[model samples]
Target: MSDWEEDWDNGDSKATSKPYNKRNNAKDNSISNRSDESGRHRSSENRAPIRYPQAGEKRSNGQRHKHSEKIEVPSDLVGMLIGRGGANIQRIQNDYNVRVDLDKESGTATINGNTEQNVKDAYNDIEHHLNNGPGSRYNSKDGSSGHQSNAIYNFQLKGRNNKPGDTDDIEMDPSGVIDWEALNKKAKKERAARWSKLPELRKDFYNEDPEVANLTPREVARLREENNNITVSRVFQQENVSENIPNPVWKFEQCFSAYPDLLEEIYKQDFRKPSPIQSQAWPILLKGEDMIGIAQTGTGKTLAFLLPAMIHTEYQLTPRSQRKGPNVLVLAPTRELALQIEKEVNKYSFRGMKAVCVYGGGNRREQISVVKGGVEIIICTPGRLNDLIEAEVIDVTSITYLILDEADRMLDMGFEPQIRKVLLDIRPDRQTVMTSATWPPGVRRLAQSYMSNPIQVCVGSLDLAATHTVKQVIEIMDDGDKFYKIREFVRNMGKDDKAIVFCGKKTRADDLSSDLTLEGYMCACIHGSREQSDREQAIADITSGHIKLLIATDVASRGLDIEDITHVINFDFPRNIEEYVHRVGRTGRAGRSGTSISFITREDWGVAKELISILEEADQEVPIDLRNMAERFKSMKDRRANESSKFNDRDGNSGSRGYRGGGGAGGRGRRDRY
Candidate 1:
């Protein structure tokens, strides 16, 4: 199970049950002042991929908010299909890899999956079974599924007391602007493309010289090794990269000679040359090509897209006043990221073009007022932006440059609904660029669905590879010894050295901060449970050197860009391998060398194999015991799978699917699966 241990909100990341404030309700008095996090005021929601609450809801403990689709069955056939002792339901859960909350009294079974596709598949299968069950009235004589009525009732639960599909405080748009019909229509169109779906991972694309059509993860990693961050053609192309793709610009003048204003901004920052990603990304983005930028954090991804967005906005034939919405739209996964992008946009004045970051937690009216007044660029989190769109305060019809920054992270936080909702209204022909550290299936699926023929630009390896600049150290120890291990490591740091301690849980971070503080360490902590303002202060302390240590969860892993961070201590190995890469990335940033210390334990055996692989990829030394643990875990898993296969064979059931309830449950799972 993931951090939430609950199914994702059908992969939409909407508030399944717990809603924040009503749309356009009076300003939330509790929230005051302008916040940089264009995301909602997350109450420590942690890394729950199921539900991302809006402004008013509380998720301090980072619990899962159950959003479900309930199907009403005839009371007579319910028991028959359910099977005795709920055996049939358990089989469905294991077979389809979904969750079913049986409401025997109501004769309704609630179905949910970690992703949208999974939920839809499970729902369809259940409906089929119900129709074919013993004495099912819907069953046809030809062994075909009979005409099924509307048995599924979908609802977004509200409040703590409400159950799945609860119908309280549900709001509807009378103007037909935010209706489901139009959104579904738009979604149906996005799926028409051949590459819109995630490719099955069974094929091997890792030969010495792989075929051009096979763009597998291993092949991408191999290309990263061969290219060594240099721009190359065809070897890494996804077949869609056209013959005349623009060449990378090494010198600043070579790319920006047309825009002296932009050149001046580059000089102001004292930037000498284009970074690896920026070198290649500029020409493609400036050419209005849809792109997927696979680069690490702090590699200047913002300017790669932002500069082009400005150029695109200025060249637009439509007048600013006549345009319904801003010509450029930037969707960030978190409030911090949205705010960061807006700040970058501010650094360089682009024809006096205005930009606003709208996220959760901030005063909505202030953001809306900024957009309504007039703006050429809009930087916002998905929820807040969606709210503004539904309220009709902002229009996306005129948007020509759309950016999904940290696109993979947005999906991990379950912001797909907000992203998809906003994209539905935008023109399909817009130039879209999605930047991500990892190219997971979810992000790829999103690109295929929304983007035109996209050119993939990967600076580093795509196989969950670690930053080569960072020195990775792995320690095998008991949980009791971890505190002392980190303490000793911190004690040896230089005066100017700064470090971030990452813990898995919010309470663990708070507890560790307390422990470290009592031991006379200058430290602060931030996690999903922390308030937006507190998170700001924690980041501020580390950046200003006011505190030597900043304890954090994955919240600070991606967006926080403090250049002087000297070390990263994985007080707890991250929940997954991709997160581990992101956590370590916080330290080794912007060409700066850094060190990362990770402590492993027996219980974390499942992660051992990938950990070793990441270590090897970075040329970091791996302990012998860690490799042993990985082998043992792999053997144990295979053994269990073999036993289960035999059992399934005896029972005459299909159970060959791998990794149940893990990554296999959702197509969006990290491709770093061992």
Candidate 2:
């Protein structure tokens, strides 16, 4: 056996049963003739370690020991053992008088029964019944079974496929062929008896529902309350389609057809429909027009510009025989986000197009090697990319396609200087495309400075943040009780549901995640201070479903795109109204409906008011109390602006200055972080 297999067998989980074959005796007159035959072993030797059964290893005395022998079972047979509500499993356990504990969270089960032999016998019986179809051996018509003696009886083990060696020889004798009619009669009688007593086994599992059992008492109550408030008719209530439809200046459908393989891959991954942003942005970008798309994260923004970038590269790429520098460059805000965009872009850039991802915090030597090898598409974070550019490790002169994803976050992270340098280093006639979740004044000004005659595309209203799939809710609570409320909500979440908690500052994000971990929640905190490797692992943990809760600062608010985040909790309200939308947008993604809940405190009344005003302008329903509170803050807005130095002098640098739109390519405006 391989070392990996031995290691798995030695774990707390072990298998049962070895393979054996039996043949009729030749000398016996009542039996048939004997023939030489070969059968395959269904035990550990034939199965891969990855799919090894994770049940029945420990003894009742709480002693854990490894079994020298191993058992092998088919994958289909294993699935049957875990019958509807695990009914078949219960029968075998009761018959053998053992205890079974299945841990779905760990993806393993434990069998605690007295002694090794009894546990082994129970496993064999369970395996035997499951190996056969429903209602054939253990399960009856309704998938039930009867209580029977738990004895480890011998049965010929068979493999799904026959042995390789040919065996056509058959020894025939009059005594060997005797009694086929009598055997059929006995088999029919045994089946009838088993069927009559199967109800007890069926009832044990038929009434069991894992979904209900998995939910906590609080979650069950919340689920019931949500359903009770709506009637069947009300649930299907439809709103009239708005007439103010967005008109795109350009549209192209067959553009991606040239790369049929790329399209097939996208569809195979189940991204069936193009998002509003993608539908609008693809045409302008494919036409080689500089454009900026303003849409929230989790709305397929990556693919919006990515498809166009890929399409353009198809025409502009250099011949494979001749090596060249990167023709397309994509710069994102954070390391995690840059890597994510790289992964998405690589999924489609096949057929001779070389795409490579470059980021900081690993091995710089490895990154340099990739750049030296020559790639047409480059996905990189600003700081790392800039370092490479400065060191002359990467050539940017050939770059004609420049994409700035999460432009707002990139600017916030002080990448403006690095962005300006990249622009200067790249081709003069380059097509620039910038995307952001929300188009605030800061992002608009940055676009004006960089893009030339660009077409602007915005999905939905600027005030309406996140996607329609995300249900938004604001709950008023005292500052002191906010933590408790959040804790209670998390405790009520279903096993499959995941939640991201957003905090205002990095320190707060770290503290909250730490606190949650200590409180028995599997969570990880991500922020600027964390190393790049750790950040990558943290994002992977959340994306791979290993960690259910993620606490992060605004660094996670934008940039990072993880699919199917069931909920987003705003532990601390955003500083700006635009950020409020980005924070909640993470939850509802990839066409899945999600929920966002924010705990509004007295200290956050100002920010809460602004958020409601934005939502109201976007045509969303707003509470009367929130609207009134928001109104109080608005009355003092102008007074506070006048007193502040930001707006004191219009002509002064470092103050709020009105935008003086730039002419030609790369306009200019007031400098702000996002």
Best by TM-score: 1
- In the range 531-618, model 1's lDDT, one tens digit per residue, is 6678778888888999989998777777787888999988878878988988888887877899998888666777888899999988
Q: Against the hidden reference, what TM-scores do the models get?
A: 0.67, 0.56
Clashing pairs in 2: 32-176, 43-72, 135-139, 144-202, 449-667
Per-residue lDDT for 1-674 in model 2, tens only? 32112211222012111121123111111111111123322222332221212344333445454432233444545445554334445444444445554444344445556667656765555545543343344333332332111111111112222221111221212322223345456556755664453211100001113443455656544542342111111111237733221223112323455556767767666655566666545545665667777666776778877776666665553543453567679987666677788788767646667788876555668888977887778988766676566556787876767898888777665567767877766655678888876666777777777776567766655554546677788887655677788789889999889989987667767777777789998998887666667777889899899999898877677666777799999887776666787777787787788888887655565675567755565456676767765665555555455655645565564564322111111222212111
lDDT of 2 at 61: 49
Q: Give the runs in model 2 whose Cα sits over 4 Å from its true position.
A: 1-253, 462-464, 617-625, 631-674
Off by over 4 Å in 1: 1-227, 230-242, 642-674
Q: Where is model 1 poorest over a 10-residue stretch in terms of lDDT? A: 200-209
| Deviation in Å, model 1, residue 586 alpha carbon | 0.6
